[model samples]
Target chain A: MSIVGEIIISALLLVGAGFMLVGSLGLARLADPLQRLHGPTKATTVGIGAILMASMLYQFVGHDKISFHEFLIALFLFITAPISAHLLAKAYLHMNRTDRE
Target chain B: MISIALAVSAAAISFSVVLNLWRLLVGPTPTDRLLALDTMVINSIALIILFGMSYATFIYFEAALLFAMVAFVATISFCKYLLRGNVIE
Candidate 1:
């Protein structure tokens, strides 16, 4: 890989991982479960997205072969993350109401 | 430089996971625990992808795909049980 390509891959990976760490930090530090939901869904989505994009580039530029399968995982995560977060939030609210009664 | 970045990324993510674990154990409510679990799932996925990058192999792709599916199902089921009072009902 050229220096440019290498730098791009490294940048992507570092940014992705940094976001991942930050998301988890939010998860740990946030005051409420509902507030915590924002961390993984939003930040981790971008984090993993960046990481996947970096992987795709590394495979194509370093090995001279283009790989598209990485996109599948990214797509799946993007689609499912919101649904799960929604469900979890609803459940939290539902149970919280019951627990108080 | 790439090696250093990868190492640092991995360390950061691992520390994040540890932080998530702490939250999971200290959960004041089940929802908190569930959220922690969900966060861990995503964090692990990030870690696996990074591992794949470091090794320059695509094999981790399958594991990552399967984990995403399983995590979704697990989250939905956990929520379903709470919402409906039964997992399948």
Candidate 2:
């Protein structure tokens, strides 16, 4: 890769790292449990995704090897995260319903 | 090329984390927090994969896979606990 490209890649990685840090910080700092949850789900997700993509790109361009595992992981995450979240929410709602009765 | 892709994806993941964080901070119920935690774990798995690529090693990928499996089980247990007030019940 060209020096310019390397510089750009590094810059992007730094930005992604910053995002992850910020997200984690928010998660730790948020007051309520509900509020704390948002930080990792949104900001941290993007941060981690960017970093993973960068890794894949690096391997593809620099090493000239086919890479698909990360994609698979991404797919798995996209599918499962929502489902788990839904289940948890449902359970919480169920608990609340029982409590109110 | 791979580096660029990794960088972009990382940035995208970061955006996702921020959005989830917003939801967590403003959530009105405990369920919302739990949901966010689930999301975070998924994101972390992705991050581990990226780190593996960055380091040019397969260990990170293995770790990620393990995390994914464990996370699923953990979520199930937590959800069960939430519903029945006991993990085994």
Candidate 3:
């Protein structure tokens, strides 16, 4: 790959890593569970997508191989995250309901 | 070109993470925490993919995939437990 390409890839990686770090920090420091969900669902999803795109670009440019594994992971994550969040939130609501009864 | 792209993407992702952190800090309930955790796992998967590209290796992809599977299962179980008071129930 050309030097410019390499530089771009590195930049993407760094940015992606920064996002991941921020997301984790948010996860750890959030004050309440309901509010905490906002951080990971939105920011983290975008952050992860950026990183994955960078990786795919790097592999495509350098190795000449269209690595689809990353895509598979991304797909799995995209499909499952919302479901998990929904389930958890539902559970929480159910518990609250029971407690109030 | 590739490096520059990667770097830029990484930086953007980092900014998002920071924003998420702000939400986590102010969340008002336990469900919010779990939601943050779910987002964290997704971000981790992306980070793993970036690592795979940086190192020019495929092993990281496998690990990332595995982590996703485990995270999904764990989340489901936890949610079930919370709702019914037992995974079996």
Q: Score every model by TM-score.
A: 0.96, 0.66, 0.73
**lDDT score for residue A5 of model 2:** 53
* Candidate 2 lDDT over residue span A44-74, tens digit each: 5566566556556666666777677666665
* Model 1 agreement with the true structure over B8-65: per-residue lDDT tens digits: 8889889988988998999977878888888788889888988887887878889998
* Model 2 interface RMSD over true interface Cα atoms: 6.0
| Stretches of candidate 2 exceeding 4 Å from the true structure | A93-101, B1-54, B85-89
Error of 3 at A3 (Å): 4.3
Candidate 3, B1-89: lDDT as tens digits: 45455455545555555555555565555566456556656765665665565566877788898998998998888788777779975
- The worst-scoring run of ten residues by lDDT in candidate 1 chain A lies at A61-70
Which candidate ranks first by DockQ, i.e. highest?
1
Best by lDDT: 1
- Give DockQ for candidates 1 onward, in order: 0.81, 0.27, 0.45
Q: Where does model 1 exceed 4 Å of error? A: none
Every candidate's lDDT: 0.87, 0.65, 0.67
Q: TM-score, chain A, per candidate?
A: 0.97, 0.77, 0.84
Query: In model 1, what is chain B's TM-score?
Result: 0.95
lDDT of candidate 3 over A16-78, digit per residue (tens): 566566656666666655555555665566566666766777778888989888788778777
Docking class of 1: high
